[model samples]
Target: MKITYRFLLFFFSCAAFFHPIKNAVAQENWPIKPITMIIPFPPGGVADTVGRPVADALSRSLGQPVIVENRAGAGGGIGMAAVAKAKPDGYTILLALSSISIIPEADKILGKPPSYSLSQLKPIARFTADPTVLVVRSDSPWQNYYQFIDAMRKSPGKYNFGSSGNYGTMHVPMEMLKASQKFFMVHIPYTGAGPAIVGLLGGQVDAVATGPSSIVQYIKAGRVRALAHWGEGRLASLPDVPSFKEMGVPIQFAQWAGLFVPAGTSDFITNKLREASKVASNDEKVRLIINTAGSPIQYLDAPEFKAYWDADAKQMEEAVKKIGKVE
Candidate 1:
């Protein structure tokens, strides 16, 4: 009986010791299977333009396929909410935009329950920063930023500006412009950047506020002419077009794309993802693809991304307060 008791105790002790070791090994071997990158916008949008390339790079680095899944709806809330509630195992990740920081505050302004809190996400890295540009049809009467502003001021509500959706990244920036400039134009909100740009091309809207990637092709094709970019300086691709600051608008905003995992994800997994993202961000092919999309490849690691995200969140919160609700 004594020998049997000793044997049982030893067995339990060994099992207890090995259990945590097994878990550690499992975590160390993270991403043994495929990973899914959730892009909260339709294909051909900024997220898709950046996410797909990053996903490809990650796949090569991790030795596993990283699939990009588009879950476009609710101005990016639906897809973001899904990632927020997903298991914190680093398998399911988010390729998020500036709207992720804006939508939560917009929801509060609209008196809706929060879809996802900033705390629910852990920023892995930031890959791109593309400034927003306001563009008009090439055939429009307004030839430059001054002309467009003058026309809008003279005829309030005569021109209409289209965006991705209500209270989205594109919408909020336009709202800020209106508030600052005291110009009035009908706000036209579309489902995503693709449709919003389509609206502009189809003559459904007077102008569109979007990232360079979404409309660079149209701008090059002479289908649309950029009036102003919301950046501190001119874009290399559109050097002649002045920035909002140059025009005395005092607006500088860019739609940044980054990788995120659910909150509470293990540090080990997060570090692994961060390392993989660093590799992907520096990949020559990935950089080429992102540059071709018209968004500069600006990489920030996890710690830096977290700080940037916090600052961006605060800025968006204040902007939302000034713009009030979309309705």
Candidate 2:
């Protein structure tokens, strides 16, 4: 009987050594399958341009295919809703932009609020930051930020500005400016940034509020003049342009984009995704792509990014309450 008991103990000990239930090494082995990155905007836009780079980098890092699928419409709602409804498995993620929170505020203009709230998604990482720029045609009379404001103050509603869409993310800042300045200008909305830029280029609009990427080419060619960047300081790419704050305008807005998975994702999978995203953001290829897109790398880890988003959401809500809807 003693020999049999000793033999049983040895068998159990060997089984325990060979099979561990949970460990760091085991969790690192995640993403056993391909990942689907959903871009909540159409192709040839800012979001799509930035997403491809990170997707390629993630594919190389995880040794699995990372596909970017565009689901445009409803001002990023359709794709975002799809992501929120996807399985909580780490395989699916949404490239959330300022629009993720803006949509709710613009709801009155859109006719209703978004179907899914921020709570529906788990924050993964903040990948990039880009500021909006106030621009005008090269031959326009307004030479600088002050000249533009003086023109507005002297002849209210005489000038007009173009933005990506009606009651969209880019339009919100313009709304705030109009209210604070107590000036008037016809707001023309385009289907997207491309069309809005075309309006400015064709001399159809007096000025525009767009990002560096949309106006980089025109600004470089001297076809358009950058009056000011909507931030605390000048952009690295446009060193000479003054920031709105520096001019004592009290206006500054920067838009950011991040990654998120559907809520209810397991902690193990979420952590794995965060690790993979960090690796992808640092990849050399990703750096080149992001630089070309005109949005510099400003990656924020999970906790910090979440706080940023929360604050941004609160700010948007207040802006909406103050200005009401654009439509």
Candidate 3:
């Protein structure tokens, strides 16, 4: 009996050791094949800007060629929906933006509902966040947010403001501002933030509400003048620009980026991706890229990210209510 028990114990010990080793190997080789990172917006937008570097870093870390596929259309719904329907094999992920949370609300205003709910995807990590800025031509007459708001208040719907898309971060905040300030401004939605900046630069629009990533270059070139940032505080990149509150405007908003995999992906693979993202976000190269772009690399691990996202969504809903139903 004693000999039989000793043999059984040895067998169990070997199985426990080998099982973990085998699992680790399998997890490490997750993307043995090329992986796809989906950017829901067109190239040259914030999502693309942040995603490219991450893809490069992830490729090196995973030993696989990671590619960024631009699937821009339908206000980011088309690409996001693709992610929801993707196989949960840890090979595909969505570079989700703050706009992802508002798709359902925006759709409700349009009399249509989003095909896939936010719950269908698993949040991996919150990669970066950028404050929205209100910019105009450097040579234009408006000097500050108050002056701009005074003009808009007098003219109401006569002013024109350009944004990336209908439900984009830039659009939503501007709409809320108009409603709160009791003004009417015609909103022009471009395919992406790049085109919106181009429109502003070409004198096609009176002003633009965009992230610093797209407009910082022009600010540095003395081509565009920043009126105010829609953040609690000023952006480090444009220290001269004031916040909305400081400008006496009670509205604030920002754009955030995160990573997500399909809901059914294995927990181990998702954890691995999360760990890699954390490392990439903290890398010196990534920091330089974000700072040079005028946006900071803000990292929020799983739990913190969920809380932040939830509060943002709730605030958006309240803003939508106060701004009235928009289409």
Candidate 4:
């Protein structure tokens, strides 16, 4: 009987001892297969634009192809929830917008079970935080920012705007404008920003308040007009555009893209990916793609990004509270 008990004790001891070694080996051999980076918004939006470049850069650094999948919906909730529940094996990651902070808070306000919690994800890096611009078709009657707001006030629900989703990054900023400035537009929600932009261009919707990455190309092509932005000063690239602060609109908002992994992912894997992100964001090709789109790279490592994420989440919650249960 003593021999059996000793045997059991020895077995347990070896099991504990080898468990970490097994994990270490697994983490070290990670990306033996391709890694997937999920962009919560569809193609052509800020998330996709930033995500693709980052993915390309990361693939070069990690020696494995980093594939991007667009899982767009629910103000990015569909993709965000998928990544949150994904195996914490580091093969899956989220490249989401600041809307990453909004969806869970919005679910609370809507009295629904949250699709996922902020605690379910860990920040990996922040790639870009660019000011949002308000745009209309170039031929639209409103010639300037002041004229645009004055028209919205006069027309109210007669005019319309489209957004990525109900409480999406794009929608929240417009809602902020509506609440703060005492105006209203018939709000139209699309599955993602790419579709929202399509709606705007097809004349299905009249305006879009969106990240410059999503619209600067269109502006340069003269397909859209940029009357005002949610910044205190003009963008270096779009000098002719006016800012909300300069116009006394009393509201400001910016769209940011950041990376996240599921909680409880092995620390080794997290650090590996984080290091890859640092290298990717600094790559000259990545920098040029982002800068040409009018959002210069604004990279932050994990710890600093978490600090920024926390504060932004708080601000989004407060603003949502004031807006309150938009139907």
Best by lDDT: 4
Instruction: Estimate TM-scores for all models.
Output: 0.94, 0.84, 0.89, 0.95
Segments in model 2 whose C-alpha atoms lie over 4 Å from true places = 1-33, 108-113
Q: Residue by residue across 1-327, what tens digits does model 4's lDDT show?
A: 357988989999999999999888878988788899999878989999899999998899888899999998888999999999999998899999998888888999999999999999999999999888999998899889778889889987999999998988779889998887889998999988899999999999999999998899999999999988888798987999988899787888879999999998978888989999999888999999999998999899999999999998998888888778976
TM-score head-to-head 1 vs 4, winner: 4
Ranking by TM-score: 4, 1, 3, 2
> Which 10 residues in a row give candidate 2 its minimum summed lDDT?
19-28
lDDT of 1 by residue, 1-327 (tens): 357988999999999999999988988888799999999888878888889989999999888899999999988889999999999988899998999998888888899999999899999999988789999999999999889999999999988988888888789889989988999999988878888888999999999888887888899999999999998887877888899898788887889999999998999999888999999999999888878767878899999989998998899889888988778
- List RMSD in Å for every model shown: 2.4, 6.3, 6.0, 1.9
lDDT of 4 at 266: 78
- In order, the Cα lDDT scores of the candidates are 0.90, 0.79, 0.83, 0.90
lDDT of 1: 0.90
Error of 4 at 70 (Å): 0.6
Model 2 C-alpha lDDT versus the unseen true structure: 0.79
- Candidate 4 or 2, higher lDDT: 4
Candidate order by decreasing lDDT: 4, 1, 3, 2
What is the Cα-based lDDT of residue 49 in candidate 2?
64
lDDT of 3: 0.83
Quantify how close model 3 is to the true structure by its C-alpha RMSD in Å.
Answer: 6.0
